[model samples]
Target: MTRFSLNQWTTRHWPMPDLLAGCAAAGVDVGLWREPVAEYGLTRTAKLVQEHGLTVTSLCRAGFFQRPDALEDNRRAIEETAALGAPVLCLVSGGLPEGSRDVDGARSRVADLLAELAPYAGEHGVQLALEPLHPMYCSDRCVVSTLAQALDMAAPFSPTQVGVMVDTYHLWWDPAVWDGIARAGAEDRIALFQVADWVTPLPEGVLTGRGMLGDGCVELRRFREAVDATGYTGPIEVEIFNDELWAMPGPAALDLALSRFAQHVV
Candidate 1:
């Protein structure tokens, strides 16, 4: 379980304090989101994590480039990530503007803005990890929807300043994922690795449809092996988003996730 990290969203409703205590007791790291961190107070949360001897694997986001204030917001996120001692800041490049159908323009904007933020991230000792959401999200959530696209965007910057995020839930459907993983490894552009199974009959809105490990058709171990083969020894974060899982007590949900992770991913 040394490499295991519980992404806070997997148990979204868990109170901050309890989540910290649980992760520390389990001897695993955590992947935190901006919302809960803001609500709990960043300084307090950082202190608590230190007191409990827990490490934060990564910070959940600083993108959504469509917003007018995205650049400023991402800069703040980089500072927050530095404060938490986290090494990576995940980026979810936001979708199109209000009614704009210029998909190419939106994607180009992501690259342009990233050029501005990558140096800032490097100065703060943080890596901007570009996450490619599933293509279905392209119209509404993320314009970068493939690993290749993410790598291409990261190519113009140093690997330490900009890297691509590898999330099984999002890349599972891409036939070129294996090759992309290899390319990322060769270029040293893999910043973070996250896992979540893709389940059928997706829930309404499709936001909370992520399945726990082993509950779906994803070859969890295969994905793990692919990442590991690239010499990526970083934390493997479990980032499921299921309503039923959130309904359970935090500790229970974590235990189940760990068990499933060991059985299917390890």
Candidate 2:
């Protein structure tokens, strides 16, 4: 059976210690965010995970090629992931820089930035996992918004050092998603798999409007089956970003996530 994990953003406001304790108690692996890990102190956070016998599935993100300090920041992120014993560092390539509408140029920067970081990440035994956010975020958040695009961006690098992330919430609407997953599998580029359902009437920014599993139209189990068919044996991370979920008590949210994950994903 495929294993299930929870991304920390699903309960964004949850305190780190409490969240870690909850996941340990529930025997669930967790996807961590850089901010909280930094705020809580990197060494402390790693020790906490070790003490609880918890697994850090992957670090949230470390990409924004447009930023002047992007490379340095990513180097720190790579070190952090190594400290946490996480194998993947998710990358959300930033959109076209201010006043720039050249999408192709921005994507080229993504590839170039990966070339610089891939070797460093590999040195640390971490994979740079490029995540394609929803196209709605193409303008300001992530320029890479499709599995194909992410895979292509990761193509030139070694698969062990650079790979694509498959998040159901982002790729659910694409008709070619199944084929994309197959290509990712065949290319050995699936660095991570995230689960989130789709919901309409998106909020002003559409950042936190993800639907809980089974509450929307996504064929969650089908996506899970597709990923499994690819021979991936890693954690299936639930990463809902709905406001309601973030408002619940962390434990309550976690319990609900576990139940929904069992029902709709695996």
Candidate 3:
């Protein structure tokens, strides 16, 4: 369980305190989201995690560069991540601005913004982890849609200040993923590795359709092996986004994720 971290969204409904206690009892770490942390009170949440002896693997996100407040928001996120003692801050680069078709421009904006924010992250002792969402979300969710692209964006920054996130759910279809993983390791650019399977007939509002481990066509173990080969000895966070899974009680969902992670991810 040393490398298994439960991403909070996998059991979205779990109350913060219970989630911390349960993860502590299960002997696993956690990946937290900003909203939930805010709701539970960041300082209090930090104290609780410390009390329970659970590590905060990474803080889930601060990007969306297209937004006007992106800079300030991301700075705050870096501070929050530091407060939680998380080493990485996941970033989801937002898509094109309203009525904009300049894909290249949007991608450029991400690079520019990362340059400005990476230093701030470094100052706060946090690594800005750029995440490449699936291309299907290109227009509205994330402009950075490939692991290679994410890597390129991080190239200008120091590895400790900026890195790319490797998520199976987003990069599974990329034939270059294995090579990308290798390159990331060689460059010391892999900040976090997240696991979630992709399923067909993606549900409407596809954001929440991520499958539990082993439930889809993703070569779960193969991906794990490839990542391990990269010399990355970091947490493999389970970040499934399924409604059905969310409906289950928190403990039940955690149990299922743990079981599947052991069977399919390990």
List the candidate 2 regions with Cα displacement exceeding 4 Å: none
Tens-digit lDDT string for candidate 2 (98-198): 99989999988888889999999999999999999989899898999999988888888899999999999999999999999999999999999999899
Note the Cα lDDT for every prediction shown.
Answer: 0.95, 0.92, 0.94
- lDDT-better candidate, 2 vs 3: 3
Q: Per-residue error at 110 for model 1, in Å?
A: 0.4
lDDT of 3 by residue, 22-119 (tens): 99999999999999999999999999999998899999989999999999999999999999999999999999999999999999999899989988
**C-alpha displacement of 9 in model 1, angstroms?**
0.3
**lDDT ranking, high to low:** 1, 3, 2
Model 2 lDDT vs. the true structure? 0.92
Per-candidate TM-scores read 0.99, 0.98, 0.99
For all predictions, the C-alpha RMSD in Å is 0.6, 1.0, 0.6
- For candidate 1, the per-residue lDDT at 165 reads 95
lDDT of 3 at 34: 97
Candidate 3 has its poorest 10 consecutive residues by lDDT at 145-154
| Predicted candidate 1 versus true structure: per-residue lDDT over 104-135, tens digit per residue | 99999999999999999999999999999999
Candidate 3 Cα outliers beyond 4 Å, as residue runs: none
Count of steric clashes across candidates, in order: 0, 0, 0
